[model samples]
Target: MIGVIATMTVQDGNGPQFEAVAAELIEKVRAQEDGNLLYQLTRSKADANVYKFMELYRDADALRAHGTSDYFRESFGKLGALLAGEPQIEYLDGV
Candidate 1:
């Protein structure tokens, strides 16, 4: 299994829009990606504008498929304008 963690900070006044878009993207990814084991969006308790995405995939191919999907591309395009800066992403391997 593969795990991915992505962190993003929303631009001022963009939290609601970001959350709405992310929710829809999450739903699409969960429903359409056969190798997606888990997909979750979470907000920081200390800062409402800080968000984290937790994802689990069956393997590297699954991860690649998720990144290349049309739905993901579309959603990311929208999400780009709402972000404060570049997102931070980390990849992990299951033990």
Candidate 2:
């Protein structure tokens, strides 16, 4: 299994938009990706504009496939404009 953690900072006043877009992304993956083990988008209680994601895939191929997915390309392209800064991502293994 592979785990991924990501932190995203939504643009000022764009939190709601980000949430809506992210929700759509979640639904897309859930409906289409068979190798997905876990996927979640979380907002920080202490920081209104900060969001995070926890994702798990079966293996490296699953992870790589997600990158080429239509939802990923479309969502990331749109989400980038709504973010305040570059998203931080970390990969985990041997867990």
Candidate 3:
């Protein structure tokens, strides 16, 4: 499986807003993108604004398709101003 682990830190007090948008993005992907196996958003207990996304896709094309999806493009673009720093993405191969 093609996967990605994204680490992000949101601006203070923006965690809830970011979570809401993330939830919407997940729903969109599930409903519209068949190649996406999973898209999950998580938060660190120690830091409320620290977030993570665990995603699983069929392959590179599926991963790239998600990036080009309208929901992702729009939501991710809007999230830039509310983020504390650049998101760190780690691509991986499942065993």
Candidate 4:
């Protein structure tokens, strides 16, 4: 399995738009991706503009597929405009 944790900082006043885009992307991923074990979006209580994505995939191929998906590309393009800075991403392997 593969795990990924991505942290995103949204620009001020862009949280709502970011969340809306994220919601749609999540829905598409859940409905279309068979190898996605889990995909969750979380908001920080201490910082409303900070968000985290918890993702689990079946394998490396699955992870690659998710990254290359048209939905992901499109959503990310939309998300870029709302971000305060580049996202921080971490990839992990199961112990």
Candidate 5:
């Protein structure tokens, strides 16, 4: 299994827009991606503008499929303007 924690910082007052895009993508991922064990978005308690994507994939191929999916790409494109900067990603191996 593969775990990923993707940290994203949104521009001031852009949280709603970012969340909307993420929400749509999350729905699609949940409904369409067979190899995705989990795909959830979480907001930081300390900062509303900070969010993280917690993802669990069945394997490397599954992760790659998610990364290359059309829905993922389109959603990310929508988020570009709302982001403060590049997203930070952390990959982990399941114990």
Candidate 6:
């Protein structure tokens, strides 16, 4: 199994837009990606603008598939404008 944690900070006044787009992306990921075990969006309690995508994949192939997915790319492209800076991503191996 593979775990991925991606954190993104939204630009000022862009929270709603970001969440709306992310909601669509999450729905697509869950409905279409069989390799995906978990894909969720979470907001920081301390910082409303800070968000994270908590994800789990079936394996390396699943992770790769997600990376190359057209919908993932397209959704990120839409989210780019709403981000305050580059997203921080961390990969982990399941114990």
Between candidates 3 and 6, the one scoring higher on TM-score is 6
lDDT of 4 at 30: 97
**lDDT score, candidate 1, position 35:** 94
Candidate 2 vs 6: which has more lDDT: 6
* Candidate 1 lDDT by residue in tens digits, 1-95: 99999999999999999999999999999899999999999999999989999999999999999999999999999998899999999999977
Q: Residue 71 lDDT in model 4?
A: 93
Q: Please give the lDDT score at residue 60 for candidate 4.
A: 96
lDDT of 3 by residue, 11-93 (tens): 98998888888888889999988889988888999988889899999998899899998789998987776799999999999
Q: What do the candidate models score in CA lDDT, each in turn?
A: 0.94, 0.91, 0.89, 0.95, 0.94, 0.95
lDDT of 6 by residue, 37-64 (tens): 9998999999999999999999999999
lDDT of 1: 0.94
Listed in order, each prediction's TM-score against the native is 0.96, 0.95, 0.94, 0.97, 0.96, 0.97
How many clashes does the backbone of model 5 have?
A: 0
TM-score for predicted model 1 compared with the true structure: 0.96
Candidate maximizing lDDT: 4
Model 3 TM-score (2 dp): 0.94
Taking the tens digit of each residue's C-alpha lDDT, what string does model 5 give over 1-95? 99999999999999988888999999999999999999999999999999999999999999999999999999988987788999999999988
Query: Which pairs clash inside model 4?
Result: none
Predict model 4's lDDT versus the native. 0.95
Which residue pairs clash in candidate 3? Answer: none
